[model samples]
Target: MKYCAANYQFSFHSVNMRRMNDLRGIDLNLLVVLEALLAERHISRAALRLHLSQPAVSHALGRLRQLLDDPLLVRGQGGLVPSARAHELAGPLAEALAQVRILLGPSGFQPATARRSFRLAMSDYGAMALLPGLLRAVRKIAPGIDLVVSQASREAMTAKVADGEIDLALGVFGQPPEGVHSTELFEETYACMVDAATVRGLGKLDQVAYLARSHVLVATHSERVDAIDAAVAKVGGRRKIACVLPHWSVAPALIAGTNLVLTTARRSLAAFEEDPRFAVFDPPFPLPGFGFSLIWHDRTDADPGHSWLRERVIAVAAGDEPDDAISLRS
Candidate 1:
């Protein structure tokens, strides 16, 4: 005869059949009673601890002796003493009970005292737009919490979340992967950045001037087409690509001395607001903005720590306070 256990098929032979049957008939709650009885020794004390009658405790002890095939407790000169097998089971039984208590108890996450480290996967652009505020908020509230950020491609974020490699991911996911939950944080629009000294006669760039100028393509990953390029293509226009780079950080410095224009997310331009060398303007065409979402696996959906982290991320993205206990930095 074949039996299925956790997707595996195995045959039970005569040698182990009784052990499996014993396990099937075992009541897990009896372990709790056994643990209490072993700790208290006396039936009355054990009943008090377990909120049961003395007779109930004695009956449970009788069941325990039959299960173990040994008298767990016996009378001695001073008081009830543990048998050899009971003494052998005490240490491991105590450890297992402690683990079960923790598993059954509340998650017990206190942000003020929690010393947790979380790994996040996001594109460089998303990090640039969100990290400064997120770090500030986290530092003031969860001072003990730590964050590790990684740059993952759009294709890899879903797998990273599902495999427990990344706790959360932030990006413009048009179609999120199956089994992943996402909440839209905000809609992000594009802006054209240029050097004030190098570019002239461009107050608000028209499609004609936008396409005529050389552009620095901020391709953080090796994708062939970006949002701006796709938008321009829809309108039967294309910008001249002078160079392609892997990060948004280098685009400002590269565009400062040259006539190259960089088109990227509007939130990313906040870093260059006070810099006299860079100029920010709206994109020439009416390009559709993309929505940024916080994505996590279903496995973490009900976890208290994971829920707290997601709330913080959403609050920071929405430019609001996390809670009354925590305040955002100016």
Candidate 2:
């Protein structure tokens, strides 16, 4: 496998050196634009993904074609089709871009001086119980950071997370969508919340006593039959559903003067335990607790700021304490 002539070896080495020099002369940003274009296979979609104008991406493509001396892309049935050279470049280009991203990532996170805002989605109960401690920690350590919390249905929240609309979501995720990643944050057991006045003789609920009274359920939708129903079914009984309410805040007040009983997370009734008007008790039947998890996309997996915040959230959840940000009431 030797070169037949010394002249042929010399020519090969010269061409290879010039090719390496030519690659070094191209802009890094143009490679980024090329990666997106090859991926999306359409000018408009690539532009949207890069947050760049269509004219700018088109112009970049023109430059790429000239530099590579290849057509790069040709129109086809669905969208732009990559040339043979473009196909050859696709795999290597993507891997190179990924390496570049890692090379340029933040060396480390400085929570004390970093200014960032993250959008978090959770339920009303979650906000009351978890936000106080998390807010306290953030204020004491990272005063420049901000958290915007909101509520959405599980389905909608999953979609928002996949699309990068929501930075994180804390909730009971049975099975999260494909594009997002999730990890267990904590677990919570159910408890029955009711007024103390009418429960002297019927304090501890057996199945009969539990089902005898009217119950008000807190759910985003009435069609959701939760664990309570499944447990009740196993016991061969069903509780009377007097009403289905959306928010947990209003359910306790609604049960104050009526026979309505509210079944909810035990931690949610923390402030109401010692109050004269309320009572918290274990469910008459056995019901498994739910695993609350943190949902986020893989795009933020290596971000220094996001990693720091995630650890803080897990710490707060483990050692939850109330802060002045919110107050629980009857």
Candidate 3:
């Protein structure tokens, strides 16, 4: 059934007299419970969503039924079915509560004391570059805050951010999806990693020497063609792509003992800068660099916790300790 503001207000008026008499008893928390109850349609399921005991949820439902003078949900064979009044309130109630969340904001995020979990999406390369220091900072200060990181394609990550499935994402982006905002964290350029032993103690590759060896490609699925490939085209030769994989983390292992060339972000090979077995060098050809960024939906922009997390991420990207948060932009 299609719900409208007019219909929702009309239903609210039916109980307005009773609510007006007992206005003091109408709790926002109770309404929150009602929203979950209406959404779950099962006492136990609602309790799980709210992190409350089943009896507690039942008590809240009892109070809600008394306040609204309607048995919002009734027993059904499957679970609980919403009554006419509940159907009327469901859509509008959810809409109103969403607005209320935006209105109140996150209040404030006290990372030292907060017991919250955040979900972030990024590629394996992003994880390699950002996770080490970010994790250390989280452990030192925000012990109560937990992070869950997952990897997916840029399109999947952006879609998840838009749908509220993922809180934040970090990567190089082309054009972000609608309602998503992105800020550049840092700039990265293409670099070639090769087995130093086979490359004859060379710190860099010449144009002819670069195309002679087999290459390990990190196909991000964002694009098949990149700046180096364009550069190689200008020189009238193609890279011998012996292996094409989707992850940057595994490239080092593949290029360690073989005469394989892996061209990827400089940060991807930064950890191996000191390793004598590997040589991370600039390509002989000129390749345009890309800006790595952090992206999240506008829905999370004002959230204090999310903003705090974004600060920490940006701080890490800038090679700063996350002890004090920095806001690059308002």
- Tens-digit lDDT track for model 1 on 1-330? 233562342334543567747766887777778776665567786676566898887888888888888998998775568888987776567446545544664665567776656668888778887888888878887888878787877778776665455669998776776778989999988888888775556544678777888998988677758888889998898888999988877677888787788888888888786677777888888888889888987656666666778888998899986663743221
* Whole-model lDDT, model 2: 0.78
Residues 229-324, model 3: lDDT tens digits: 888898898988898888888888998778888888998888888898888888888788899999998777867777788888888999999664
For model 2, the stretches where C-alpha displacement exceeds 4 angstroms are 1-105, 320-330
lDDT scores of the candidates, listed in order: 0.76, 0.78, 0.80
In the range 1-330, model 2's lDDT, one tens digit per residue, is 365677789999999779758867778899988877775679997787677899999999998998788999989999999899997786567546545654675576666776766668998877877888898888887898878787988887786666555668888776877767898888899899777777876665667878899898888755758788888889998878998878877777888887678888888888888887777789988888988888887666666667777777887888954242431111
Rank by lDDT, highest first. 3, 2, 1
Number of the top candidate by TM-score? 3
Model number with the top lDDT: 3
Model 1: per-residue Cα lDDT at residue 129: 75
Alpha carbon RMSD to native, model 1: 16.4
- For each of the candidates, the C-alpha root-mean-square deviation to the true structure, in angstroms, is 16.4, 10.2, 7.9
